[model samples]
Target: MVAYDGTDFSGFQVQPDQVTIQGEIEAALHRLTGETIQISGSGRTDAGVHARGQVFHFDTKSGIPLDKWRFVLNNQLPDSIVIRSVEEVSSEFHARFDVKVKEYRYCIDNGAVPDVFRHRYADHIRSPLDVEAMRQAARHLVGRHDFTSFCSAKTVVEDKVRTVYDVRVESEGQVIWVICRGNGFLYNMVRIIVGTLVEVGQGKRHPDELRTILLGRNRELAGKTAPAKGLTMWEVSYEE
Candidate 1:
């Protein structure tokens, strides 16, 4: 398992002339084993997003003990990224394909003034939100649907159907969190959902309108994509 502050990354993928999570790990692997390695991540998070439970798998011939891999990698990695754990898995296991569920969290600082400490981790929204309205809007998204309206227009995936198992809106003091758990998600889907919910909270859109937007299947029908800094990949799960 890995956790990273993605603010400095171009994205999770390896890109020429760009710093990325995969690139950094592959470089570390090369330094440690003298062999180039490529990793497959559970998802390719966009720039500025964070991950507390991102997962990746790579093939290696080195004799490094599984328990010691985490320490070895962390020693070589930048402070922004950490290897939380390492374990041997079946040769047949695939990180991206074996995923059974993914959880994402979007944080909002609803204080009258943005918290300086959380500027990079949370979205600061000064307007008082109607939590109940946001909850109602979120409920409409908790099911199987074609999320074309919520995903980015730049998305290349032709199939947009995915199951959102749950959506919860919770608050603590000045922070409001929108938690989403699903079997899968389209690119930019979670952020757009949060944006639409925020609109509902702000009384600019009705809670019931989410259904209509989903049915419309037009990206323009949904609200703006929420800023990436507020989002985090909280967890990923797989079948035992």
Candidate 2:
């Protein structure tokens, strides 16, 4: 497991000439093991996004002890990325394919003035959000459905179906939280859902209109995609 601040780099994937989370980790592994290791990540987070418990796996034949991996990697990795834990698992266990559920959290600072410390972490929205209305609007999203309306227009995935187990919106003074748990999500699905819920909280859309949006299955009917910095992959689960 790993936790990272994704403010820098071009997301988690490796691109030629682009600094990425994967590229850095692979480089560090090479420096330690004298072998180029290809790691498979649980999911690819977008640019400026964050992850608290993101997962990745790689097959290594090096003599390095498993217990020393976390310490060695952290010493070599940048401050933005930290390997939280390192353990050996069966080769059949895949990071992305074996995921049983994933949880994401989107944070919003609804204060009159944005906090300088949270600038890289949370989205600062000056407007007050109607929490009750947003909660009602999110209820329609808690189930298996086609989420095409909430997906990005640039998404190339043909099957837009996904099962969302839970959606909760809550606020603590100036901080608003949106938590989503699901079997899986499409590209930019969580951000679009947050944007739509924010629109409902701002009274720009009726709470009941969420049903229509889901049935419509058209991207144009949805709200703007919330900024990537506000999002975090909170946790991921696998079945025993």
Candidate 3:
């Protein structure tokens, strides 16, 4: 697994001409292991979608050993991506299949202007937001439910029902954080949820409106999708 700020790269997946985090990682792995390994990630993130605990796996023919995997890989990887740790597990321990939960966080700069440095990591909203309203709206999103309204219309997944264990909103000075943990998420699900919650915070929508939208199951009835730069894959869990 690794964590990275994808602002400087094209995306997580490997592309033919464009430079990507996955491409760099595969290149490094090939160079070190002398095998053409196929890397499999938990999911493909769009360009500029940052991750704090992205998981990936690849089969290696070389017997370089497990303890040195992190040191060997990190030595060749760019500073933008950091390999946190590595451990040998059963062959059945899949990165995507054996996962328990995933968490994401979206940051908002609720202020007059955005900071130049923090602009890439947080969305800047000029209007004053009602934090309490946002929190109340988020409560409706918790628990197992069909979240078709919160996902992107282009999502091709057949199943839309997902278990959202928690959704929380909090403000610390100028920063507003929207955090969500779920068993699985559809494409752009977190961004849309944040957008709707932001509408509730701005008093443009009522807290109860979230329930209506969920029941409607219409993407058109939901709020606009928020920007990707503010969103981060915060964590992933697995059963020990």
TM-score list, all predictions: 0.98, 0.98, 0.95
lDDT of 3 by residue, 99-120 (tens): 7899899999997877778788
Model 2: runs farther than 4 Å from truth? none
Between candidates 2 and 3, the TM-score winner: 2
TM-score of 3: 0.95
Clashing pairs in 1: none
Give the Cα lDDT of each candidate. Answer: 0.94, 0.94, 0.89
Q: Write the per-residue lDDT of candidate 1 for residues 1-240, one digit (tens) a residue.
A: 899999999988999999999999999999999988889999999889999999999999998988889999999999999999897889999999999999999999999999999998999999999999999999999999999999999999989999999999999899999999999989999999999999999999999999999999999999999999999999999962
Task: Report the alpha-carbon TM-score of model 1 versus the true structure.
Answer: 0.98
Q: Can you list the residue pairs that collide in candidate 3?
A: none
Return the lDDT, model 1, position 47: 89
Q: In candidate 2, where is summed lDDT lowest over 10 consecutive residues?
A: 231-240
Q: The CA-based lDDT of model 1 is what?
A: 0.94
Report residue 240 deviation for candidate 2 (angstroms): 8.0
